[model samples]
Target: MAKYKLPKPGELSSSINYNPPAKDWMDIPVEFKPATYPAAAKEKDLLTVGFPNAHQWTPEDEDWNLPDGWEDTVIKGIEERLSKYRSFKLFMDVCVRCGACADKCHFYIGTGDPKNMPVVRAELLRSVYKRYFTKAGKVLGRLAGARDLDADVLKEWWYYFFQCTECRRCSVFCPYGIDTAELTIMGRELLNLLGLNINWIAGPVAACYSKGNHLGIEPHALKSNIELMIDDIEDITGIRVNPTFNRKGAEILFVTPSGDYMGEPGIYTCMGYLMLFHELGLDYTWSTYASEGGNFGFFTSNDMAKRLNSKIYAEAKRLGVKWILGGECGHMWRVLNQYMDTWNGPADFLEVPVSPITGTRFENAKSTKMVHITEFTADLIKHNKLKLDPTRNDHLRVTFHDSCNPARGMGLFEEPRYVIKSVCNNFFEMPENTIREKTFCCGSGSGLNATENMEERMRGGFPRANAVKYVHDKHGVNMLANICAVDRAAFPALMDYWVPGVGVTGTHELVANALVMTGEKERTTNLRGEDLPGKEGNE
Candidate 1:
């Protein structure tokens, strides 16, 4: 049985005012109407600033003043760095301003401001690039309205680009197929160099640098926590789930976010994996040394991100694991599938994974033979490898909330859905706009998942919660199923505040419910074919 902890009343003070007679940050009245766009006036229209750009673009403003004697060196370094990728230059040269993607952003929908449109968001970064790298800016100077790097422009970059969740939702609707997420990433990287980084990211970045994980839990602490979880599992099921720690010569090494060891919903998923692996008798080891592969540093700088990724390969080499398996995570999978193969690995010792049961090979495998938990589970089910009872999940009227990272960032559109379908019968999907490749964010994504960003979260979270509210009202949907650990950790608070009584659960939780026995009485359906298995008083 799961342990419960009741929340104390008013335990943590909120910065945003949520009630009438609003006090400081806690109770401000919500503006139900959408924000307005900047209205166009008479100009030659050589440069088109969108309607909502009016708020952020102060044309009267002066350029940023560089620190003494560093301006030329900084400019030259930016040029060199920008030159490394031809794609960045291709992205910059390809905007026609057709306004096709204006309504495609969750932030734009929530705010109703035209500038929050993904096109405009990309423009914020592109304009700066044009000024610094192009011949027109260097010769025309002030006449071209492109100036040197200044504190004001850096501040604007921090404010607007960081608002982007980098979900790649914008890419689908762009006529030119521009990806604003890439722009936002590059913008954040440049800002990190300027030392204007957000505190939430900076804290995690420093922690990841010094302590090997974003949460700063050392190797000893990670082992201790996993051991506690293993003990709890054994005590519940009388099944020993031994996860080898830092063991050399293991066939497989597993890595996950440190949040899985420390946080609630994530920990439950951790238990589910442990239970499943024990049942399958898989050979794997967990390394406290490379406890995290989800680089929060990726949101800040490439140098720090490269360093973080380097640790995963280093630890894998030390363990001599022929392959690695990724836990159910959002950005971690994206980083693994998209970059790790080229960034830090050429693991000549490792080969593509083959199903032990079917003898079929994963011909398209990337670095260290990484696979998401859902794909593994779905494959196991396909091979008829596990015993499951779907009736155990009748209590949950669940719908899948495809996490933005895995759904859109990586092309993992089918695996999680396959896992959900195999394990539960009561599953449903949210509306098409809020599902799969078109899914909305959990609001506090991209390292903004902090108590300090509560107000901003509410502002950003409005659109996603509104989508959920529509489904709840229409179909009485009560539960959300997602795969990403961060979505599970962050969405609950948003639901509690905006749409009261709704709950979120990870996809693995439902899987565990169907399989694992917790030493408590198991629910049984009464005859007459009624849905009474998990009715009241069962717990």
Candidate 2:
């Protein structure tokens, strides 16, 4: 749209630059200029969650008006976290600065910002850790790569930390097994100490805390949204289905991210979920409360994550369900799989999640008693539980982009592809390295999917988008499928920016399109209301 500083003529490969300019890291001027997208937290958004320091603020404002004892607050916060999480201490201590993981980051590969590199991003905190805690840093100082926690350092943390999508792709390449995501989370938590947070993250967190879901959809609105979805279902399949809400003694309690009830692609995916469950005759009730599976809380802090995630179990127990069927989401599963059991409880009330129809036990989710939508669909496909017409998606040349958290954090790589391949006729994977655990982020994961950060999101999204472009050109791919809500929300912009012809959607949205329901009217359109490829102009 405008003439920007174009890259040098020969700047072709991302491998071209792994080393920063020849200067001391601290002396290197970090310019958070027009290139850096600035988005600040809104007071109204934070007010619901009772953020005491929440007031009108902007990233461009010079006076952030941090608390009086801000330096001490940060030091103490780091100390407490270090003491609590051994992983933090180990990550701080273990890095050898070999730069093996440097090129692996999506932001660094996309923006060429050295600080975006996982090693250097961690160094933002690691420098503070060395200054306050480490012995070598106390004596050697810059020689030991330690730096002070001054204003500039704080600003740098705010800038680059959000640049990370908390995608652990870097961790996959690290020889030391260092996780930059954990460091990024620690950075965000420390920044939140000074009441510094973005509006996108703070807003959803507050909404989820009070209104039961991230979009702040209350009981009435939640019911209304589903009513609209049921209307759409009837229009397509010629069958009206009734799903329960907060009904006690239900066999399964279904929960999806709040975005599913409100946002695009997500709402379409939600329609797919409803139609699939209706066809299976699965006895499941919905919950107006705990309507979110994508935990924005996980992006904030462990306490906030625990606070928001507590609803799922609370609602499940209240509804008297045997197990929870979680929808397709990114960080939500990471929390559900890794943190929920440890943070919330043994969940002794709910029974282990087993498919009552197929009788398949999810032993991996035995502790949490939660099943992923893909896993559920895969099981159903394996059993031929639903008649699927893969040819319905013949026009959609699909490729799967593994969302970072579920791919790296939980290792849910195969189940989603199995479901996608089972539902769609043609399937392609973005290069071998970029498809599975080493997959890049959507450039807008965590809480970085704000509109103000569009430019930065475009840059961070390049690696993932570039891979999509490769597949788009080679495989004639048009539909880029994923299971993450953030991807569904953010990738349209990315697709338009980098890979213009390609589109992003949820895996189950495709399944719902291809599924042949019992005694349903002959379908002429897919879930998005698009005419089916071959079904067009047919009597």
For all candidates in order, the CA lDDT equals 0.69, 0.87
Per-residue lDDT of candidate 1, residues 429-476 (tens digit): 777877788888876677777675565667677778887787777777
Local accuracy of candidate 2 as per-residue lDDT tens digits, 272-333: 99999999899999998878887887777788889888888888888889999989889888
- Prediction 1 TM-score vs. true: 0.82
Q: What is the TM-score of each candidate against the true structure?
A: 0.82, 0.94
Query: What local lDDT score does residue 280 receive in model 2, on the 0 to 100 scale?
Result: 89
Error of 1 at 203 (Å): 1.8
Please report how far candidate 2 places residue 276 from its true position, in Å: 0.3
Clashing pairs in 2: none
